[model samples]
Structures are given as structure tokens and as C-alpha cells.
Target: MSDIAAPRSSSRARNLKGGGRNRSGQTNFELYSWLFMRLSGLALVVLVLGHLFTNLMLGDGINGLDFAFVAGKWASPLWQVWDLLMLWLAMLHGTNGMRTIINDYAEKDQTRFWLKALLLTASIVIVVLGTLVIFTFDPCLDPHSTLSVCQ
Candidate 1:
């Protein structure tokens, strides 16, 4: 038998590099994205906890939640702004996380492009609709409403 040995394959050979490097070579976008995820996650924890505490722990708790309860909360400018920030941050964080997942998992260029396009479109639509709902909300807009709060 021959004494020659077969060459070993490297794990590095199977490792795939992502398109995380900026093509224009102008900025470390991936690094920023990484940092954003960490910071935003921390902020989200606080924001979400505060939101839950305010909505569920204060006053009558979850049992007091209703359309009028929501209207009362939104009537306050402070609550409106708080909710807006929460909405924007949560949507952006979720969208960015999904983008990273798609970039890492989708191998086909066309597939990746289309998937990202769909994600971006959905994100924009949700953000826009949510913002509109938050800002344009009117609890008394109904003319035939029966709720005393609406009156």
C-alpha cells in the first residue's frame, strides 16, 4: 500500500461570508447594525417593561383595558409620544433582525433580493399605518357613538 496521506479539508472552506462589508467602502455598516441591535434590544426591554407596567400594573390593571381606556391614554400627549416611540423602535428592530436573517440564510441572489423587497415593503406599510393610527386617532369621531366617554 502507498504511504501517501490524503489532504484534510478545512472547516473554513465551508464557512460563507456575508455581504456585510459596505460595497462603497465608505462605512462599517455591519458594525453599526450589530451595535444597534444590542443597544436597541436593551432599550426595548425598558420601553416594553414600562409600557406593560403603565398599562397593566397601574390603575385597574388588565381588567380596565377597553376602547375608552385606550382613548384616555392616547388623549395624553405624553402617552402618545411614548407609544409612538415604542411602535417605531419595535418595528425597526424587528425589520432589521429579519433583514439579517434573510441575508444569512437565503443563498440565491434573486431569492434574497425578492425576500428583502417584500420585508421592506411590509415594514414601511406597518410603520406608516401604525403612525397614522397613533397620530390621527379620534375617540369622539363617531357621531352615533353610545359610549359616554365619546360624548
Candidate 2:
């Protein structure tokens, strides 16, 4: 290997001198997003693994998962809150992650805006629906329904 090897250079290496505000006028939003990604990713690992373990390991495992089974779990406040927390955290984390990816790759402003708009819509829809399912679920509904635990 040569002593210098032509020296390495990248966008971050060159400081933007008088470029506007960032030296290159780069907004701190990207930096904040990067930090959020790391923190959220770490949390997601724990939340997801715990979820999988509880739902697929303890007792009958995956074989036990079903509509009635879900209703029974949701009948308890603990599982309800647990699932609510999991839903919100994972949704926000995933949305922010996708935002980062979009910002990093999208070239045009309109393209970036549209992609983010779609991501936000989908995230919000899922989060709201998931939260509703966790909270408004009536385990006692339909006494004759075979699928309901209340039956």
C-alpha cells in the first residue's frame, strides 16, 4: 500500500465554507434523524424480540395464536397496553426509518414530499387501526359466535 493511497475523500470530509448556514448549509434535521434511527432501532430489537418470545415461545407458542386467543389476551389490560405500546413504538420507528431512507435517496423536492406523504399516511392508518383494535375490542361481543371467547 502506498503511504498516502491518494487520500480518502467524502462529502462529510469537505466542510462547506460560507455555503449559507451549515458551512454547506446542511440542516441539523438529518443528524437528528440519524440519532433517532439508532435509538429507535435499539428499542425495536427489544420490543420485537420480547413480542415474539411471549407470543411464540411461552406455552403452546404459535399454535395457540388465533382470534379467540387474541380476544382472551386483549381481555386483560396488561396485554392491551403492551400491544398498544408495541404498536406505537414500532410504527413511529418504522416511519422515521423510511423517512431517513427517502431523504437520503430522493433527488427532487416533489419526489421527496410525495414519498413522505405516502409514508406518513400509511403509518398513521396502521397506528390508528392497531390502537383501536387494542382498545375498542369487545371480548364479550356475540355470545353465540364460536370465534368469541365470551361464547
Candidate 3:
């Protein structure tokens, strides 16, 4: 018999890698991140599709989308919360994906660190601004605004 092991089947090859066994000092960050990507992607699909349907198919369709329509929609607490959730999930999901890409492509530790730092800073800025806009939105910015919400 040859000293080298025989070629294994796909299942056997997969079993070679550690499966469900927790090794000391090994964090499960990657696993959790992978899971989060899947869950957030599913949620985003639902949120985006619902938003599109509400905006394009309901009411006056595409023509109804004006400043007043936006003001009216944002005036509701429910729509505010919905938009807030969508903004947060989309930002986080996209950031996580970009982080993964940086990790995979960047060769040096310093390069990875800088790239991730930039990504994190940008993500934080966007999420904070978006959340603030969603919660603090005022449809009646102008005193003479004709929007019904303004009245």
C-alpha cells in the first residue's frame, strides 16, 4: 500500500474539517457573521419589496410620489419605524459584506485595519444620520407649507 492516504469522497472530505466542535481560544465570530448575513438578507428582501409595493402599486402609483406624498408617509409612526428598520438592516448588511471582502482581499494587517476602520466610520455616519432623519423628520419645515401634515 502507498504511504499517501486514498482519495476520499466529498462527504469524507467535508468531515475532515472540524464540525460543531468548539476549540479553545477559537471565536465563532465568522459563524455568527455568516448567519447574520443570511438572516438580514432575507429580512431586507421582505422590507424592500413591501416598500416598493406600497410606493408603486398602491395609492396613485408612480405619479402619486411627490413631496407631499413623502411628507404624508413619514408623518405616520408606523412608516417611520419601518423605514428606520430598513435603513439599519441595509447598512449593517452591506458593511458586513464589505468587511468580509476586505478581510479576504487585503494582504497586510495594517491595510485590513485601515480599510475596516474607514468602512466602520462610514457605516456609523450613515446609520446615525438615517436614524436621526427617520425619527426627527418634520414634514412642516416651512411655516407656509401646504402639506396636510403641516396643517
Residue 61's lDDT in candidate 3: 92
Q: Residue 35, candidate 1: how far off, in angstroms? A: 1.6
Worst 10 residues of 3 by lDDT: 16-25
Which pairs clash in model 1? none
Give the alpha carbon lDDT tens digit for every residue of 1-151 in model 1. Answer: 5876544433223232323434343357778888888888888898899999988999999999988888888989989998898898899899999999999999999999999999999999999999999989988877887767766
Write the residue-wise lDDT of candidate 3 on 23-101 in tens digits. 4434577898899999999999999999999999998899999878878888788888889999999998999999989
Top model by lDDT, which number?
A: 3
Once fitted onto the true fold, the runs of candidate 2 whose alpha carbons sit more than 4 angstroms away are 1-32, 145-151
Top TM-score hit? 3
lDDT of 2 by residue, 1-151 (tens): 5675544444435544433336554766667767877887788788789889988999799899977788877878887877887788788878997988998999999999999999999999999999887778886676677764554
lDDT of 2 at 86: 78
RMSD of each: 10.8, 10.9, 9.0
Q: What lDDT, from 0 to 1, does candidate 1 have?
A: 0.85
Error of 2 at 20 (Å): 18
Model 3 ranges with Cα > 4 A deviation: 1-22, 59-63
